[model samples]
Target chain A: MENKILEIVNTVLENRGKKAIRKINPSMSLRNDLDMDSLDLAELTVRIEAEFDIDIFEDGIVNTVGEIYAKLNIK
Target chain B: MNVLITGVSKGLGLKLTEVLLNNGCTVYGISRSLSPELERLITEFGSNLKWLRYDLSDTNNLKTEVFKHWIGLGTPIHAFVNNAALAYDDVITNMNLDALENMYAVNVFSPLMMTKLVIRQMLLHKIKGSIVHISSISVHTGYKGLSMYASTKGALEAFSKNTAREWGALGIRSNCVVAGFMETEMSSTLSEDQKNRIYQRTSLKQQVDVESVANTISFLLSDESRSITGQNIHVDCGTI
Candidate 1:
């Protein structure tokens, strides 16, 4: 599950011309560590939803890579 | 290509369906009910056309009745035409809230929500899709008793512009086709005098042909218009 999360996150970042995130720490801030703007975050959310068939934003905003995995209930 | 169209039972929407099907594309259409014309087309086209019967005014049920159904199909929708709309004729002071809300549900909310559905599907499948909103010249030039209706179209134009800006990076495009007065059920309510007064303002001095408008929509959806996005192409015959 962690590997899949890492793969999806890195792919999205790579598409946005960011370096591939080799590691995703639970405490890494999405906006600061990943350098994601509002549109980038929106695209990330959409990619996540498409991959898992879940609305990560259904409850609220998530700000970290861990939060996304946790929202998908991935271990 | 898989295309989704709203208000496909009549007027411009119906003409669009005919053109798309004739061009050998699959179409999924939604409307309150099937018209005889649509029924005839269905019989003639067979599997190429799929129909969903749902009232656009019932925006709440749109998820279950429309979007979810398309998602469940597992097919990538390559284009969307937000063509379904309702017009309420009244002065601003005399406008009815209930009617306005109903019209907004069909004209504004439905199209926006439907765009969300198609965009997600397009991104998932990596299909560079196009979306066209059907707007009215009434938005550009005001007519008496059309303020509320025109406001809905203006809202759509605004949304389409922003959608194009946001999604262009993803190779997905959005645009609007501003239509002029046409001879359809929507305009049948207008008296001949009212129609003539409206027609005189256009450079063409005639009602716009629905087929030409439908063909324009097809062109926008094609690869030929790949460079175009966030533009409101007026099919209004210089009505402004």
Candidate 2:
């Protein structure tokens, strides 16, 4: 699940012409560390929903990679 | 081209569906009920015309029911026509809250939600999609007993402009076709005198042709109008 999330994050980054990250940490801030804007976050949400069939940002704003895992119940 | 259009059971929506299909484009049409005309078109077009019976009032289930389950993420929607609308015509003094909310749900909220999902689909597929919202000249001109209905269209026009501005960088164009009064079921309730009075307001002094509005929508959806976005193209008969 973590690796899949990493891939999705990297996809969003690459689409924006940003460099892909080596690893994704739980504490990593999506907006700060990954440099994702609202539009990028929307893309990420849709891609994540397409893969997991769960909308991470449906209930509330997801600011970090850990919140996404929590939304998908990965823990 | 693959287009998703709402209110395909009748009026401008039905005409637009036919025009798009005639142009060799696949249509995913949504309406609350299946009109016989739309049914006939489905039979004639076969796989090219996909019909779904959906009430736009239920904005909550749109993503699941219409987008995911019906159209599917695999189908790349190249364009979206937000045409379905509920006209709760009443003077401001006689306004009913329930009816107003219901109209807003169908006319404004549903289209807004659909636009969001459609843009997301475009983003996923990396497609430079077009979005056209069907607006009304009533939004521009003052019409008695059309305040509530026109308000919904006004909101849509505002939303379209903002959507175009926000998504233009990604090549996703958004626009509104502000149509004049047409001789469709939507205007069936109006008396001949009232209809004529409305028509006289336009320079042409005749009912706006439904075909013309549909063709304008087609042009907006095609690459022919690639440079046109964030615009309210008035297809009204030069409404003064």
Candidate 3:
């Protein structure tokens, strides 16, 4: 699940022509660490939803990879 | 082009569907009920015309029922026509809260939700999509007992402009077709005298042709209008 989330995050980053991160930590801030803006977050949400069938941003704003895992019940 | 259009059972929506289909574009049409005309079109077009019976009043199910289950994430929606709207015609004095909310739900809320999902779909597919919202000249001109209905259209026009501004960088265009009064079921309730008075306001002094409005929509959806976005293209007959 973490690897898949990393791939999705990297997909969004690479789409924006940004550097792809090799690893995603639980405490990594999506905006600060990944340099994702609101639109990028939206893209991330849709891509995540497409893959997991769960909308991470549906219930509330997700700030970290850990929060997304929690939304997907990946703990 | 795979275009998702709402209110495809009749009026401008039906005409637009036919026009798009004739232009060799696939249509995913949504209406509350299946009219015989739409059924016939479905039979004629086969896989080209996909019909989904959905009430726009239920904005909640848009993501689940319409987008996820029906259109699917894999299918790239090249364009979205937000045409379905509920007409809550009443003078301000006789305004009913419940009816107003219901109208807003269908006209404003549902379209807003649909636009969000459609943009998301476009983003996922990396498609430079177009979104056209069907507005009314009533929004521009004062109409008797049409204030509520016009308010909904006004909201759409505003939304479309902002959507264009926000998504223009991504090549997603948003626009509104501000159509004049047409001879359709929507205007069936108007008396002949009232209709004539409305028509007289336009320079053409005749009912706005539905075909013209439909064609305008098709143009907006196509690459022909690629440079046009964040605009209210008035298909009205010079309503001053």
Tens-place lDDT per residue, model 2, B1-240, is: 999999999999999999999999999999999999999999999999999999999999999999989999988999999999888887899998999999999999999999999998998898999999999999999999999999999999999999999999889999999999999989899999999999999999999999999999999999999999999999999996
lDDT of 3 by residue, B207-227 (tens): 999999999999999999999
Candidate 1: interface RMSD equals 3.1
> Where does model 1 sit among the CAPRI classes?
acceptable
At residue B97, candidate 3 shows an lDDT of: 95
TM-score of chain A of 2: 0.97
Interface RMSD (C-alpha) of each candidate?
3.1, 0.6, 0.5
Model 3 TM-score, 2 decimals = 0.97
Score candidate 2 by lDDT. 0.95
Worst 10 residues of 2 chain B by lDDT: B82-91
lDDT of 3 at A6: 96
CAPRI rating of model 2: high
Give me the displacement of residue A56 in model 1, in angstroms.
0.4
Tens digit of per-residue lDDT, candidate 2, span A10-63: 999999899999999989999999999998998999899889989888788999
**Predictions in order: lDDT:** 0.87, 0.95, 0.94
lDDT of 1 at B98: 92
Looking at model 2, residue B7 earns an lDDT score of: 97
lDDT of the structure predicted as candidate 3:
0.94
Ranking under DockQ, best-scoring first?
Answer: 3, 2, 1
